[model samples]
Target: MSVIFGLAAAVAVVAALGVVVAQRTLYSALALVANMVALAVLFLTLDAQFLAAVQIIVYAGAVMVLFVFIIALLSPGAQERLHPLEARVLIGGLAAVAFTVVVARLTLNGVSVAASGRFYGRLGPFAPVLVDRHGQVQTLGEQLFTTFLLPFELSSLLLLVAAVGAVYLSRRRRAS
Candidate 1:
């Protein structure tokens, strides 16, 4: 399980870097899809099967399709290159190194408490026993429909608005 998680984490990191470094817009989108799929695999290794499925279906499948469609529609040209010694490139490289060091340190020394005061090992209402008894999907669905219904609905609305905004912007661009 740890091996799978580590492999997925490595893939996610590499794909994330690929997304940022890929010259073509379509290649960047493909890299993003790979990153999302790798994240789904990581979730699976954590025993979050429902989250893994949702990650694959909603992000890797639906969101990637939308991004790829947009990229195809735009038909963007080649990216402009930056000189190796450019200030922006140097700053970006430094930031990447800083980020990597911070992540490495955190991984080596595990976080005990989150900024929100939640313990890292603390279980939520959906305990492992409950999850085993009722199944992960069932427990998650119950919570989504009951405890988190409003937030769930609001997020759906937000996504709908974003999709509509994207379509509107694309059409307006074509018209102009």
Candidate 2:
């Protein structure tokens, strides 16, 4: 299990790096799809099957399709010239390294709390009162509605705003 997890993580990292460093938009989008698939695998290994499926379907499939469509619609040419490594880039790299070190230290030293405890291992009040045998979706829906309702509705609002913005931009472009 650990070996599989390691492999998935490694693949995800490489794909994510490719997304960032790839010269072409299409290649970057492809790398992003690979990264999303790797992440879905990781979610499966963590026993979050529902999340794994959602990761694949929503991110790897739908989102990547949208990205590819956008890339195809745009004129195929050098979008921007690559700049030489500057002082800001060096500083950003150092900051990223420092952040990684801090996160590693925190993770290594973190305490593993038992899930059966009163606090319920960080789930707190949001923990499911009764998990049905049906599947993760039921428990997730319960939590999302009862505990995380505000965030869920807010996310929907955000998505609505994004859709509206996309439509407005497309219309403006067409008009111009």
Candidate 3:
């Protein structure tokens, strides 16, 4: 399990970098799909089967397919290559390294604190009881519909707007 988790983590990191650094938009979108798949593997390793499935089905499947289709519709030209020693590249690399270090330190500290029973975070209301009774997926569905329905509907609305905008832009490009 640990080995699988480690491998997935490594793949996730590499794929995330690929998403940022890939030259082509299509390649970046593919990399994002890889990253999402790796994240699903990590979630699976953590025993969150529903989350893992959603990660793959919703993110890797639906979102990535949309991104790829957009890239295709846009027909973007090749990105200009930056020099290896460019100031922007150097600064970005340094920032990424610093961010990674800070995240790693925080994660390690959080794990140690939790393991030592020193982390006293607020507990969710009725989480355990709901999970015990209805299971994770059912509990999540209930909460999503009842508690988070507005936000969920708003997000769907936002996605619809984005899709409409994409189609409008693509049509405008073709018309020009």
By TM-score, the best candidate is 2
Q: Provide the TM-score for each candidate, comma-separated.
A: 0.70, 0.74, 0.71
The CA lDDT of each predicted structure is 0.87, 0.82, 0.87
Candidate 2 at 45: error in angstroms?
0.4
Tens digits of per-residue lDDT for model 2 on 84-142?
Answer: 69787788789989999999887655543333333334544323443335467887887
CA shift at 39, candidate 2, in angstroms?
0.9
Kindly list the per-residue Cα lDDT of model 1 for residues 1-176, writing each as its tens digit.
87888899999999999998888888989999999999999888878899989998988898789989988888665556658899998999999899999988886555544445555566775887789999999999998999999999999999899999999999999999
Give the residue spans of candidate 3 off by over 4 A: 21-25, 70-75, 84-102, 117-119, 125-130, 163-176
Better of 1 and 3 by TM-score: 3
Candidate 3 lDDT over 1-176, as tens digits, reads 98999999999999998988888888989999999999999988876789999889988898789889989898576566668999998999999899999999999998998799864677563455557777888878888899899999999999999999999999999998
Cα displacement (Å) at residue 42, model 3: 0.8
List ranges where model 2 is wrong by over 4 Å: 75-79, 87-95, 98-102, 109-134, 172-176
**Pairs in steric clash, model 3:** none
